[model samples]
Target: MQPRRLALANQKGGAGKTATTLGLASAIAARGGDVLVVDIDQQGNATKGTGIVATEDLVTTADLMSRAETGALERAIIPTPWDGVDLVPSDISLGNIESDGSNDLVFRLDMAFEGVDLSAYDAVLFDCPPSLGKVLFSALIAADGVIAVTEPTIDSVEGVQNLITTLEGVRRRPNPRLVLDKIVIGRRRNTGEHIAREAELRNAYGDTVARTMIPELAARQDAHSERKKIHDFRGGRAVALQVAYDDLLDELNLTSSRVQEKGA
Candidate 1:
């Protein structure tokens, strides 16, 4: 059986998309399950977060997107320092693909993975760019589902709605199998405005909003800066972040056993 491919996305920057992607990958690794993370964001935050720096010699997602062939992804896949997690790193050059005029440009990402076996992974996650551009569309076309990550803020809420609209379009044509799996509330704070916004989203999109809310904790950034998984990081409330990601993994049914159960 093939693992589920999901895109963690938000049209707004600072919505914790990369953090959530890495956190979930870390949680899966902690459970002895492997995951493949494909970084399609120009910022390369997810690439760096997984402890792999994209040197000029490295084969990246940018290269994969530029090609129109199969069997290329295997060579681009590299093991990360994080156990049980591999990555297709990305760099700023990915931004150039956005403006390409080729008619089949958006389909290249899915084509790149054709005939490749992904059963070794529990999940395949695409850390998408913070925009509804070609890069994001390419990921949506290739993915089985989407997890929209957003902050508990007005602008972020609007961004989630925009993402939903985009998903509807993708489903109607390019990728009818694509589903919006969940809306994850990330970087949540205890402030009054945040609390109100969170309530608004839950009431409006009930059940689709994940029950697990990722708190705005400094340890997340600290662990990222140190290039260590939150499960291994030891200070500044890292335990809280770790528990949240674990809960999210369970909620999403992303564990290998849980995924098998679902398929059964």
Candidate 2:
């Protein structure tokens, strides 16, 4: 079965891409859906966030990208400490691999995920690098749709537009079926300024900006340091997050799964 891949991308940094990716992947897994997180960033923040240690001993994306056959890549897939989730972790070697002129980089990642059976997983989350590079293109080709995370600010909004243009350009060629299904405005607040920004984004991009606005909660940030997901403890954070993710999935008519209870 073709796995529905989602990329949490933004041209600007600190748009909560990593946080969104981790939360969604973990949430999907918590709901009993098997999930895989591909850490495409050279920084390996997502890898670190998931507590994947990288001291050069482990096989990583670097090895996979350079290999002729993805046998090594599939071998590198690690069942992370996270339940119902597996990872093709990133590492420092990723810095040496440039997407600028790689030979067929787009199809490269696409093939990496091919052999594996994605039927059990409800989704595959690609934590993309913060640039328009081979990794993003590759993820786009593999993904059925993408969710661009934008903050409630103008600079971030501008970056979001540029990202869309870049994706549009890619779709014109290698990823003709690629659909940037929705733009997510995360960390929304109740201030008048926030409302205006949201309105502006809606006016600018129309309905592509999803109706689900993830509220900024202190606990969401707190969960990070604990190496825990916001979905774990119930309350405002979990309810709001669940609503946003479920709304996005509903918009796409996608199915959700239930994972065994944590530590069961």
Worst 10 residues of 1 by lDDT: 255-264
Evaluated against the true structure, the overall lDDT of model 1 is 0.93
Candidate 1 lands at a TM-score of 0.97
For each candidate in turn, the TM-score is 0.97, 0.87
lDDT of 1 by residue, 1-264 (tens): 789999999999999999999999999888878899999999999999988989998998889889787778888999999988999999999989988989998998999888999988999999999899999999999999999999999999999999999999999998999999999999999999999999999998999999999999999999999999999999999999999999999999978484455453
The lDDT per prediction is 0.93, 0.74
In candidate 1, residue 140 scores what lDDT?
A: 98
Worst 10 residues of 2 by lDDT: 255-264
The runs of at least 3 residues in candidate 2 whose Cα sits more than 4 Å from the true structure, single-residue gaps closed, are 70-73, 234-239, 246-253, 257-264
Q: How much is the lDDT of residue 263 in candidate 2?
A: 29
lDDT of 2 by residue, 1-264 (tens): 556778778878888788788877766665566777888888887787777777666767766676545434467678876777788889767766674466765676777666766666667788888877666666777777788988888878888988889888878987787788788888888988788889999998899988877788876676666666566645446667766655655564444322332321
Q: What lDDT would candidate 2 get against the real structure?
A: 0.74
For model 1, how big is the CA root-mean-square deviation? 2.2
